[model samples]
Each structure stands twice: as C-alpha cells, then as structure tokens.
Target: MRFVSKLTMALVGALALFGVGFATVTPADAASGTIHFSIVKGGFFVGAEGGNGVLEFRGRRYPLSIGGISGGLVFGASQTNFSGRVTNIRRASDVAGTYGAAGAGAAVGAGVRVITLRNEKGAILRLQGQQVGLMANLDLSGLVISMRR
Candidate 1:
C-alpha cells in the first residue's frame, strides 16, 4: 500500500507539470476587425452569391472578394449589403477561408438580416445588414473569401 501511494503521487506530479507546460505553449488570443460587403443572390433550385468587400484591420483597409453557391429550396433574387465584425482572427489574411453557411431567409422589398458564420481557421463573422428585392432560400452554402492584390 505504501509503494502504491508513492507511485500514484509521482504520476500526479508528472501530469501537473505536463499540463502547465502545454498551457504555456498555447496560442495567443485572437484579434478582430470590421468588414463590409455586398452580395447578389438568385436562382430557381440552386443559388449563387458573389460580391466584394473591404476589411479594416490595424488601421488599414484590405480589399476582399466573396463568392458562394447554395442549394435546396432556393428561388427569386435579391441583394444584401452586410457590415460587421470578424473575430478570432490573427491577421487580415486569416479572414480568407471557406466558411460553411446554413440558413433560411425570405424577403420582399427590404428586410434586416443577421448571420454568424465560422471558417475552418476558427474565424467568426457576425454580420447584419439590409436585403432588398424579392428572394427566399432554405439551403446549405459554402462561402469563400479571398484577399485581393
């Protein structure tokens, strides 16, 4: 019993040391920035959206392009202009990635829209904006954003 207790204590001490080391090696906290973009979407069964935007980060602006395709119960057409904050990013380039989007919306004339999407790199875009014209959709989409040269 005495030998077992000593071995258990030794194992616990090693685990504590390992945990501390790993914690110290973790990545730094991410940064956030502002973004503005516009998208025009329309279709019958499958829909497509694309637009251009700018990212304001670290007191500089970077131009960006957005495009995506969506399927399932999509119809009509409309344009959406969004402005919001992109978080969990380390740099402006980190905002460039494939973001998975699943949403349902309907609009006639004009309406308010809000959505939160996360990319593979863990960047999250929380956007809200105005959508105009006639449109409706219930689908899954993949939106890709890239920095322009």
Candidate 2:
C-alpha cells in the first residue's frame, strides 16, 4: 500500500509537469487589429464557401477567402454561412491550404458555439470591428482564433 501511494504521487507530479509544459508551448493570442470585409452570402454551413475579400490589420493587407461552414439560429429562424480569413498575402496557396484549414476550423468552432446557444442569431460578421485573439503554431502557419465583438 505504501509503495502504491508513492508511485501514484509520482505519476500525478509527472502529469502536472507535462501539463505545464504543454500550456507553455501553445501559441499565444494575436494582437488587436482591424479586419475589414463584406459578407457575401448566408446559409447552413454557409461560411465554408470562399469569396474574394481583403483584411487590413496593422497596416498590412491580407487577401481573404471564405471557404468554411457557418450555421446558427436567431428569433426562431435557422441559417448557415461559410467564411475564412487571410493569413498570408504573399502565399495564397499556403493560406488556402494550411492557414485556411486552421481558420476554417476556428470559425466553425466559434460558429458552433453560436449555433448551440438557444438565443443567438446566425450571422457572418466581420472580424474588423470585433476584438479577436489568435493562438497559432510556432511557425505562425496554423492558428486558432477566439473573438469577442
């Protein structure tokens, strides 16, 4: 019994240390900036579809594509939309491939939250007027963004 307790304690300590390391390695949030764009359309899984757009932040131009799904409900009505942000202006393929995937995932996740809520409307809003924080990989390629309007 004594030996088992000591082993369990050691295991717990190791797990705590691993958790700390993992938290430290995760990417921090993106700095505040303005992202201007227009909503092209709306429907279920709506934001997944791509539309031509531009994102202006920190005096940089990020050409955006909306190719993700968005869905939600508001005032007894259902809706969906697809959209994605531009992370790399110079590397469109990378943005469309990797960064796009990451952005899509983040957008879908955020959209789901609105969907699950009973009293929220399904709308594809712009990121420019909202406050958003981005948690991305070390290379700044893949990212997870959380936002508040």
Question: Which is the leading candidate under lDDT?
Answer: 1
Off by over 4 Å in 1: 1-28
Provide the TM-score for each candidate, comma-separated.
0.82, 0.29
The clash count for each model shown is 0, 18
lDDT for model 2, on a 0 to 1 scale? 0.32
Per-candidate RMSD vs. true structure? Answer: 5.9, 14.8
Model 2 / residue 5 / CA error / Å: 29
Q: Candidate 1's residue-wise lDDT over 1-149, tens digit each? A: 99999998898789887784433323465788999999998899899999999999989999999999999989999999999999888789989999997889899999999999988888899999999989988999889999998
lDDT string for model 2 (1-149, tens) is 99999998898789887785433322242222333333332333222223445544566566654433433321111123323333322321222232222222233212331211000111122232221222111111121122222
The TM-score that candidate 1 achieves is 0.82
Which runs in model 2 stand beyond 4 Å of their true positions?
Answer: 1-30, 42-49, 70-149
